[model samples]
Target chain A: MLEIKNLHVKLEEEDKVILKGVNLTVETGKVHAIMGPNGSGKSTLSYVLSGRDGYEVTDGSALLEGEELLEMEPEERAAAGLFLAFQYPVEIPGVGNMTFLRTALNAQRKARGQDELSAGEFLKVVREKAKTLKIDADMLKRPVNVGFSGGEKKRNEILQMAMLEPKMCILDETDSGLDVDAMRLVADGVNALRDAGRSFLVITHYQRLLDHIKPDVVHIMADGRIIQTGGPELALEVEQNGYADILKAHGLTEAV
Target chain B: MGAAVQKSTLEARLEGLSTTGFAPAARKDALARLVAMGLPGRRDEYWRWTNPADFIAATPVPAQAFDDSDEAPVFEATDRVKLVFVDGVFDADASDDLALAGVEITRLAEAPDLNWASGLYGTLEVAGQTPVARPLAALNTAAATDGLLIRATAKAEKPINLIYIHRSEVSDPILHHVIRLEEGAELTILENGPAGARFNKVMEVDVAKGARFHHVRVQGRDHERRAATAIFARVAEEALFKSFTLTVNGVLTRNECVIDMVGDDAVAHVAGAALGDGASDAFLHDDTVFVTHGAERGESRQVFKKVLKHGAVGTFQGKILVKPGAQKTDGYQISQSLLLDDDSQFLAKPELEIYADDVKCSHGSTTGAIDETALFYLRSRGVPMEEARGLLVLSFLADAIDEIEDEGLRDDIVGRLEAWLNRHRD
Candidate 1:
């Protein structure tokens, strides 16, 4: 459902290339995990695919179901069934979380030429989805992520992904700030949204998140490129042995 | 003692007023004050940010009514006793019978000789003309033709709504209103509509001991209108005084509020929300507020917010004064503006004068564009760019609108603000 070929992206304001000659694809119903250390161009790939500003995509193309995703605006990407769970969700002071979610959901619906949900209908759906994620009424009422614990923010992001029901989801380091319990909870939220038509690109530094969400394909990314690709066992191999041997085998020295 | 000064065009306009009818004494004193101060020039300290010359210039700009769709003025949804004024004259035929219980409303033109109102005609304006000069208010007092004299003996059964309609294209309306809330009395005064092409209004309020007064005003909607309005209030012992003003659009608008907390343990709050879009080249909105904590344990707050876009200008001049021996006084003043784009501008002057060692007074002013991160976050969630901008703009004004104590009234004001945003969004 999602494809990336020879993608090259660089910081727009700086003379540095973050993604170089990267190629990846996640078929429908597949969960792809990209494991790499810090500055491995993992998050850059997510941001580029999500159409974030400040990135100059010099070469290659990202496609979603045969549609050119890179040419679309950030909001257009969202309406095109693309979702990115931000590594750090922004806190909007006066915008209630529930209101933000409803606006987003309806905006996407309107962009897709679908009827918008009434207030009552939206509230009912939000309550049901929030309950499954263990997000209480209070968390849904406060300004988006303001004063929320790190884990609550992650959960809120998951709730949004579920509400929007995007076809391709990108979790950018979703487990970085989460504790073991919070990681499990977030993974469970993502698991509940899994279906035959949905796909996930889970980016992380560690393999513990994969243990919970269970990726179908594992790719080891280093130095701005995916160096290796394997099945689920590849995550355990890196977790047990670390990336040092893998780097040596690839004839590259450790970054540090 | 000295020879009478020469008159400028604005001064000549004031000089031509027919003083044969109203309180000639008050008009004479006010006219002298205006002449002494002369219309505030751009060089003057207070007028540096907002000039009255364009508003008070002779041969006023030819009036052209802004064609807003027919909509009910705010408070039309509420049960209020409506008093209509058209072209500065009281419209008795369109107004409700002045029979509100616990409240007495008299036309200033009919009762010009009444001692109660004449005593207060220019009292607050004169009292506030210390330290700084408000020559335009003095001009309004000297030239005003008609307004209301309201007195509340007990709790008013319903709010008194003053609706000003501008039917004349070239009308230059000057009006002054005097309101006195007796001891233990309570009243709510609601004013709305664009009065005329060029409007000058002054409202003086006296809240007696233990009285409660609420004043909510929504300025005219005409984008080409020019207005200079003042609300001067004095709070007595244990009384409560609150006032809020909302301005949508105008060529030039200067709203000055001077409040004195003269009674022990009294509370006073004055707030305003102004929205000026690209309605005209010189769309200017100014709010100049001076709040005084005179007695012991007095509390005062001034909250003003402005949203400007498309080269529009917004200005705020606010001060809080804590008098000596006014121990335990608490005062707060904040003026903020959201400039939607690169062209819009916001000018603010905030000051604090505290003579009491035991008082807590703070003032702050901030001007900034909408948060881009917040904007992107909303847009990323699928909200359109314009709708996202609108949401953030309204959120910025929510704090100032919250100063309105009544929920229904606050909602009414928010609705008006939303309507303005919908029309002006780029």
Candidate 2:
């Protein structure tokens, strides 16, 4: 469902490189987990796939369903069924959460040449999805993410992912800033939306999140490149021993 | 004075007024006051950000009216006694009869005597001359041809709406209105439309003890007209006075509001929302306010928001003053602007003066472009860039818009703001 070939990215304003010669592929109906330590370009990969600015893609291509994703605008990529659940949801003051969701949904629908949802139709779907996430009507009525608790923000992100229903969903550090209960709720929300036509790219720093949303394949990423690919057991191995064993096994030393 | 100050072109034009129906003493006093304070020069501290040259010119450059058929003036959807004015002259044929229980309304042209409004006709305007010179308002008081005289003895059954329509290409309109709310009375006043090519207007209000007054005004819709308006109000003991103004840009528009809380426990709030997106030379919108807390334990708030795009300019000069004996006075003032483009400009001057030791007064002013992080978030969620920009702009002005007391009127004003945003959004 998503393909990346020799993807190289760097900060546009500086001389630093983030992702260097990275390649990954996720097939239909499959879930892939990329576990990496801080500054290993995990979030950068997600941002590059979702078409964020401030990064120059110096080389290679990222395609969604064989269409060049990097060439499309962010909104266009969204219309093309690419969704990125941010690590930190932005707080938009004075913009009601429900209003933002409705606008976003209708905008995507219109961009894809589909009929837009009516207010009532959108409200019904939003309420139903919000209920499972434990988001009350008050949270939907308040400004987006403004004064929201960390768990509430994560749930809000999950609610958006459910509403958009994209072909490729990238959860970038969604487990960060979440307690065990919040993580369970978020995992439940994501698991409920799992379908054959949709794929998931779960990017994380720890193996705990992978336990809740078990990945079909686990890739241990270090220094912007995938060093190993294994099954669900690899996550438990990392959780028990940390990235030191993996780096050593790959004939590399951890930074002092 | 060794050398007489040269009469400005505007003053020369006022010199030709017949003043036939005006009270001689009042007109003379007002004209002398205007002459003493010559038209605010560009170098004047108050006029530094907003130039008065174009508005005070003898022959204002005429502008073709904008076609606003898709958007109706606020309050057109509500039922009220409409006081219509065309080219500064009262239009009786197109207006509802000035008939409402507990309220007495009169046209200034029809009432030639010193009249019930004598005490307030130009008193507030003259009193406002102290910290700075507002020569345009003084001129309006001197040469205004017609306006309304409203008196509310009890709760007004219906809101009084003053609708000004511009029909002539080269019209210059001057009007001064006086409003008095008796003790225990309640009233709401609504004003809308473009008065003329060059318009000068003044509204003086007196809210008595325990009275309540609500004012909502939507300034001219013409993009090229130059307008100067002032609101001078005095709130007495336990009275409540709240006023909100929504302005769309003209070539030059300046609105000065002066409010004095004279009686203990009185409350006053003055707010404005202005949008100016000059496609050509930048349109200018200015809100100048001076609020004084004179009595003990009074409260006053001043909020102003402006949205400027495509090289447009917005300015705010607001001050909150607490008298020496006005202990425990509470005052808050904030002015903010959203600059849509790099060429657009926002200039604000916020001041606070508290002589009373126990008073609490805070004032703030800010100017910024849209939040890029928030914009990206919205766009990533599939909202188009333009729509996202519009939403943020509206949100930037929401706090000030919420100051409107009437829900229906607030909705209508918000609709007008949305329409403006849609037209200007790229």
Error of 2 at A243 (Å): 1.2
Question: Backbone clash tally for model 2?
Answer: 0
Clashing pairs in 1: none
Q: What is the lDDT of residue A199 in candidate 2?
A: 97
Candidate with top TM-score is: 2
Q: Give the TM-score of candidate 2.
A: 0.95
Task: Write down the C-alpha DockQ for each prediction.
Answer: 0.59, 0.75
CAPRI tier for the interface of model 1: medium
Interface RMSD of 1: 1.4
Q: What lDDT does the true structure give each of the candidates?
A: 0.88, 0.88
Among these predictions, the greatest DockQ belongs to 2
Which portions of model 2 miss their true places by more than 4 Å? Answer: A251-256, B1-11
TM-scores, one per candidate: 0.93, 0.95
